[model samples]
Target: MSTHLNDGSLTPLYQQLMEEIKVGILNNEYVPGEKILSEMELSELYHVSRITVRRAIEELCTEGYLVKQQGKGTFVNPRKMSRKIEQIGDVMGFSEACRACGMVPGAKVLTVQRCPVRADEKRFFSLDSEENVLYLQRVRTADGEPIMIENSFFPYNAFKSLNPNELNDASLFKYLKNTFGRTPTSTSQTTLEIVRASTELATYLDIITGDPLFYMNAYFLDQNKEPLLIGRQYIVGSRFVFNF
Candidate 1:
């Protein structure tokens, strides 16, 4: 790697530095989400002034190639995955969305157990006071990159046969469809909000604590309009895009 910059070139020093950094990113010299050299280190390595290094870093950030976390250093930005949110009839799962964006989808089951029904779960599942609900938590990924934390709830009696071991790296939607003949076709209700990541969520999504996340609550229904499941997802804000 040539770090020497031409002082005689007509191109500004900052632009030259920017190009070099961009090339480094393109060549996998700086992997996604990996922190880059500090301003002083970059200045020394590129033989440029601190101002020049700062300007280059700023431009890279503006171009979406880098991101600056408060008090933490600048890091490479992951490629944002885009999902189209249409009417309730056009619901898409995370795996389908990832494939549409030319990325591989992955999931790691974090927790699976039968838990006492919450108020909302009872209301959605029409469960009695004594009934419990099946709770499942997973770290959803795209191309080996952690993207979201998925917390899903299902009627315990209806899904008690689910094998926790099979959920690792498997699509719950597909499993429900194939095993129980229950297909989630549309969402009956959906809401989106912004929330700060808790420590556990940050660890799961590989983000800093208090980072912004897109919190989504959705009630899913089968084709016959029968309720199937409820989903509460916390997605990394900088790594996802939603089109309405």
Candidate 2:
């Protein structure tokens, strides 16, 4: 069946269309791997031009709401993983969490460096402008499968001198607790929508351009309630499932 668009509201036709489609996905009215109506079908039903329908569908696909296969119709995402905010404390480590679920935990440490903090980084990590940050970039794997690509920042003053090997062998949170006697007492996170994987990310995570990627921004607090770290994780849709 074709989705509908109203002409009475002040909302732009495209936006109205997008919102309706988003609601359908969230409400489980349109399920994953299900094909959405074709542009011609939608145009005919909405009494709008095929271009209008095409634009709406294209935008949706770019925003990760839908996917299109050449010569095939657009379909909903086939793999959507649940990201539990409440489980941050118990299983903050991606590898560990995946392993607990019977998936192998694997990671590739892409970059590890101690760099001067950016203005935003300073604020996020609760550091002074002069303080540096230990930046760690890694792509985590589950059962030999790529799942998440992460770029995390830690206050250099807090961790003293963090070694590259430490992050590679064990969870960063575990290292902080065991080596420094400080653990994450709590965490705050935000998620944003982003599309188009970078070439580097695409190669590492094994996804193509225009593929869906979730941008997860997180802040971890220490036992003393001080901000311990700030990070961004780019998770592949296939490896993640977010459930409310």
Candidate 3:
């Protein structure tokens, strides 16, 4: 509401402008996907220099509160999806987490094939070097918005009966539980890190190349403590949050 910036304040002009714009977004003054005022207009309105306005906008974009489109303008970003990391005994899948957040979960199967097992996969599943594994890649969505890319591997001999067609827009965990009587109850190991989106990943997740993403590698175990599968997920940083 207040367009005037106080030069007397200790905060830098750019930071002050950033906070004001953030407040506008939170207050719905700037709706998601709505193009915001140009830097020149913002500078004129706030009585600040163009450099100050540019810095504020840049920071907001980096923080995921805004997005800049080439030739177009800056727009407000959609709210981030959230997932909680609970105790070891409590594990939640993407679909379950989306449902809990009151969003419709969907998946688009990207790739399904049998691939030679990597050394790590062989060790995790206690398989021989000659064994192969069923690999599945999918783009997961919440309410029709692409959120993450899921790369999962299952022991071919045990889950060779899996139907790839059934995976589209379906819950893999639920399917495994009902069809194979195998429920993923826990994760033996999980590692989290940040990664830049590749061109292919950018296309899949509908994000810009080099955008930040959260990469997770997890080894899952069934209810009976049997090795189940390995998951490698690349989540859109601007559209997802991890609650620990």
Candidate 4:
């Protein structure tokens, strides 16, 4: 760490400290919610002034990388949020991914409601007058670990008598195949802007609010190219990472 910093480098000493700490967190050397060393300890450890350490910590806190308790020292921020990007046109369900990864898939159904489709959804799904929609919200987990929060709207009649609780450990695609003899052969997904985790979402996922998170909107289609499911997923960046 010392080799990366130069006294004559255009960067300030505090900035160097912040960059090193940031890298440490990303590399998992410093974990989220883990207390950092105190000012005096950091000063001694880095051979820097206490003021420099304080400034460095303050900048990190303001940038949402660290949290400071009134009486306690600062702590590394919680895990980075994540999303898994499937190959284009590949069809799989949330539970299948968890199962394949050797993790048990779990879900907590938050709400079930019959509602008219929103305007944006209408255009996206090309809704017909005959199609009735049901809104489903569930927090998906793996091996009892919170991973994603799903907000979806499906055609009610296609999944008639479906209870959200019964979806545990069952892939949505598999259910479609078994119950309705339908399956999604392909899908289109779009990732939106990165955003800070919300209080409710963070609480559900056991992370601090304002943590980094990824947002995704996906459209699933059946073998016949008919829309099967349209949904949005809020992924926990820390729990999962993807290459594409």
Candidate 5:
């Protein structure tokens, strides 16, 4: 560690300290919720001033890489969340991804209604604007912690028989295949954007308005290449690092 941190290097000593501590935390050298060494101890360990160590810790806290308790020193954040579903896109639903990460997954169905497609949705589905569709608004959780808001739109005929109550704690992917004999064979397109959370999204995601969140729009196709559904998800960024 001393060999990598240089006094004459372009990077400030505090920045160097931040990087060093971040690596330790990310590598589990300092496990989540574990208190890091005190500033004086870090100063002695790194052969730097206490102020430098304090500054590093402060920056890490502000970045969501660490958290500080008033009288408890600083601790590694437990919410270094990661979800990687595929190479280019997270084709798997949120529940599956969370389970793969060793976290219990759950969902709360917020809204279920059959409604007419809006103009943009009609264009994407290649349907008449007056045609109705099945829409669902859901909140996804990992280990019972709310994580994202999922808004999905599907053609009515394909899922007309689906019971909204069945989705309270269910996986949409599994339900579709088991009940409708529908399987997603391919992803036609997906878009990613970094945006501040809207009020509604922030409320469901348990984040403050204007906080950074990931906005994703995905289009899935069935075996015959027929459009299956379109979904938009707002994922909180501070608690997650999207793997795919």
Candidate 6:
């Protein structure tokens, strides 16, 4: 539905206006923790009385969809995760990192399964071209808020014997060691970048497209110093900070 308020509808003008603003919130036209247009601005745009706009916004605030910060205007209530700035050297799973920062960590798996290894994946794992790998893509959260998006590839054989339930709500590295007897001896390689979020990324991180993100790429190494898994992550820009 369009964001414009409909005056001809039987619904009260304030209710109609509320739906439009709510749609903007749901559509990321108003990002979490970002201020919405002032009452005057909204009233002018919707061609509604200022009293109608004010009542609609107040209802939104009472419904917990928005917050009014003193002197700062109304903001879409933030549901966010913030990882501290001291985690880069640990090279740990996000679950572990979140714990270290005193936040509850969770994962929402987008995809998880075994597949034929891509050429680059084979090179990373030093596998023959015929080998296959296990792939996992998840949105990581801290305290119920999306923190980062991760895509990882691991040698399928290393995980074939384990049940998915064993890893679902736990740290992947910890689960690998405890359930499958495989543990990375170290992590190698480091490449970091800041990139503009794409539409897909914006959906995952609950941010607007074109927002900046933090990117990191690394490889988990086996005891023999061979790559065990390849990990690439896009972290929400304002939600995470890493030590240099």
For lDDT, the strongest prediction is: 3
| Model 1, residue 231: C-alpha shift (Å) | 0.2
Cα lDDT for residue 56, model 1? 93
> What is the C-alpha lDDT profile of model 5 across 1-244, one tens digit per residue?
4524688989999999999988877676777888888888888888888888889999999988899888878888895677863333336667787877788888899998999888767876787876888999989888888888888899876677778788987888888888888866567888788999888788888889999988888888766777888888888888777775
Tens-digit per-residue lDDT, 61-160, candidate 4: 8877898988877898765433246555675577776766667888888888877767766765777765668888888888788888888787776665
lDDT of 5: 0.81
Task: Highest TM-score: give the candidate number.
Answer: 5
Q: What are the clashing pairs of model 3?
A: none
TM-scores of the candidates are 0.72, 0.63, 0.77, 0.69, 0.92, 0.63
Off by over 4 Å in 3: 1-58, 67-76
Write model 3 residue lDDT over 181-233, tens digit each, in one string: 99888899999999999999999999999999999999999989899999999
Q: lDDT by residue for model 6 over 200-225, one digit each (tens)?
A: 99998999999888887777776566
**Candidate 1 Cα outliers beyond 4 Å, as residue runs:** 1-76
Residue pairs that clash (backbone atoms under 3 angstroms), model 5: none
Decide which is better by TM-score, 4 or 5.
Answer: 5
Candidate 2 lDDT (Cα, 0 to 1): 0.74
Number of the candidate with higher lDDT, 2 or 5: 5
Q: What is candidate 2's CA lDDT for residue 123?
A: 76
lDDT, candidate 3, equals: 0.91
Kindly list the per-residue Cα lDDT of model 2 for residues 159-211, writing each as its tens digit: 65776677664576677778888877667665566666788788889888667
Whose TM-score is higher: candidate 3's or candidate 6's?
A: 3
Q: What ranking of all candidate models by TM-score puts the best one first?
A: 5, 3, 1, 4, 2, 6
